[model samples]
Target: MPCPACQAPSPCPQPHVGTAWKPSPDVTVERLSPGLPRRLPLRQILCLLPLALVVVVAVQHRSVLADGFGHLATAEWPWLLAAAAATCLTWVAAAVTRQGALVERLPRRRLLATQFAAGAANHLLPTGLGASAVNLRFMAVCGVPLARSSAALALYMLAESVARVGLLVALLIAFPDALRIGVLLPDGAAGPLLLAAGAVVCVALTVLLLVRRVRTVVFSFLRTALSEARSVHARPARALALWGGAITFPALQAAGLAAVGQALGLPVPPLHMAVAYLAATVAVALVPTPGGIGSVEAALIVALVAAGGPAAVATAVVLAYRIITVWLPLLPGALTLGALVRWKVI
Candidate 1:
């Protein structure tokens, strides 16, 4: 007799008798199982999508970009170079902060690349969502548990916020008149703004205290974050990297704006320009705009004017600074982000 399915000489008519039938090595199991799912090409699509979007955005904003470059062309080269340097250093500062948040050591190159990719993603999503999402993925990929990663992210954010406010207060103490809130706001707006901010904080605190489930989650998160922070601070290098990077990050950003101001011949003093940059960024930090795009530009322009620069000049400086700090690196960052996706780095 011969086996029916895979015909071969056999003692019995049954397919399983004598010798078991087997598909040739060249045939895959998928060939036998018709219902097997094919692998999706999602990673490749994700890798390319951002790059395509970047090109489209660049093309659509060609005129504005060209004008910004034109301004840079005639501006002071040395100051522009310094601004570029500061822009580059911001990535490094970000990477250091990320490393400080984790106890495990990430590969240096990949970690830095993740930060670069995170920067691109940050602009694509509202506030810091893009960056936070990327970092979370990266940490998970690096073997950090989800809860720990989330805690580390919270700690990083807290540290950065504290450092920014501390720097702002220090600057205000040093230059009391650098920015007048009264001048920036309408006659009756300042008091209302303060009250609104206070009300929001109180509401949030009340909700956290009143909701049992929410309070439990919040307490769990805080405990995890505190534990992680304590562990990180136990090591001197990590402590320095966390706090030092946090402080330096905003300072470098402020320096970049001041450098741009100098490059464009803005009449604001350097310290005043720094103050304006910090204040504008801090004020717009809560805005849900992607990378604070529109809000940041408007705020920066206003802050610069309030800091004693002419409105036209302030506008020009803001445009130029955004070009150098945001627009120029955008394409490269997108490309890098896509590469990281394809490589499964995030």
Candidate 2:
């Protein structure tokens, strides 16, 4: 039936009907913008000021760096070979750590690739945050929840720290006289002991804070810190696995450094290199600059020098370590990033 002032087909309306055509409130609507790829702005490029500073430092040290290359040319192949082997082991350790974190295991190949990409990003990114960000992105793409990813990163990081501390403590304890007489530790060996004590305190505090009751109350004051550490306690088995991996990872890295020392004909002992490795790593990790570029180079060189190597020898060893660990992985990581893009993983 058609009835209305405008002659529309509808129910009859006599005289004046209060009928009005209206859409339902439940409809979903959104604005649509035309597709146009966005370009990075110049200002955004300028945001990489920290990275630029690292480049400047590297350039400024170029003269000393040239000599390091000469040292590498005359170096033995055995140590280089050992460094390569240790590098492989270090990646394997990372994969093991990741596997331990989750209920289900991710493919070892994928995890290895992810770690490589993450490490590469960390080397380039400011504040070493890139690696964590990459890990999170990769996990999200794989359907892992944010909570799980957070926990995994924390667990592995904590485990690695503990392993490093343990190794250094062992070295200090085993060669008490060496530490006692060394210029760096010369305070009658008290300095190294004190440092070891401090590391123990940090470990003790970590355990105490993990208690449920204390976690509830103290967590408020430690909100940010706790939030960061939340992933460490997500799963007990996972934590154990991560710790095992962490211990192996740093030990392998120390081995690599030791190999570099040997290749360059430096008389630095592998065991002593382990202690220097821990100290240099902690210093670099604490630096505000991304991946500890300038700071890492400086810390490593300084530590190696202090550990009885000459300036030239220290420079060569540090550069070699950077090459094997940092630059060697970058090209593959770039390719990995491209593959990730093609697969729509990020």
Candidate 3:
């Protein structure tokens, strides 16, 4: 029998299966699809979550905020602007590095914007977790298989860590007295620490090799990671972007801190100041603070003092730098994150 409404077939008023039809402009009806995991009611929740997080973080760190604002009052605007510019460039560097970790090319603008949004997400959770979640979701939405996306994430992290430590070593070699790195470490501790770390790695590797099932899984993952790495690095452009962006990310961060130190008249020289920033970051890499908030500040201040800046001045410089790099951009970054969620970008 013909349908009364459409006068065509048995079924009446069939819904459109394609994206061209929507029930409403503001509302979204999500039909489940492979590889896309989330579809939350985003309009209000997205806005409120960031707002609440802002309040919570603010109330918790009010004193630090007060001190930073005090130092910021007398900051040199020109150099502060330079610091801001360098901070922004870190996002571009991250986007490039991420692209370099995979064979397929990502949409440049969206990747860059996702990094920006990832920054805010990063601060809200523990070190690396928030950004990893955001990027994983972004990759999933981009049609990447879960296993390959995980491999890419691992490669990106390994490359970034290597580049950061390598840059720090290069800087130390270039300027032997740039910062008193030995003083940053407790006396006679490095040897024991190194031995302990080696032992731990050896034990873990031994267990992995001895267990048949474990060894099989480990080899499988290693093969995947190596294959992906080779494929990405096989292309010169991707390889260059990977290593170049990895190096640039840390270098720009150091430069931004140096510029802020200059603005605040920290007694340390600019290059030495940069060395301080790098050493501080490297030292605190193991500390699991949200964005390394307290730990990073303390390490930076200590590093600056080791680099010949006065204790008081180093404290002020760190405060100002954190304000510019973290707090100042936080709200806008959160808003961008919310917007991306609403648009189903991540």
Reference-based TM-score, model 2: 0.68
lDDT, candidate 3, residue 67? 96
Candidate 3 collision pairs: none
Cα lDDT over the full model 2: 0.69
lDDT of 3 by residue, 321-344 (tens): 999888888888888888778788
Computed on alpha carbons, the lDDT of every model, listed in order, comes to 0.89, 0.69, 0.87
lDDT of each residue in 27-85, candidate 2, tens digit only: 32332223655666644443344345445645765764565566667789888889989
Candidate 1: lDDT over CA atoms? Answer: 0.89
RMSD of 1: 3.7
Q: For model 1, which pairs clash?
A: none
Model 1, residue 33: C-alpha shift (Å): 11
Q: In what order do the candidates fall by lDDT, top score first?
A: 1, 3, 2
Winning candidate number (TM-score): 1
For candidate 3, the 10 contiguous residues with the lowest summed lDDT are 19-28
The RMSD of every model to the true structure, in order and in angstroms, is 3.7, 8.2, 6.9
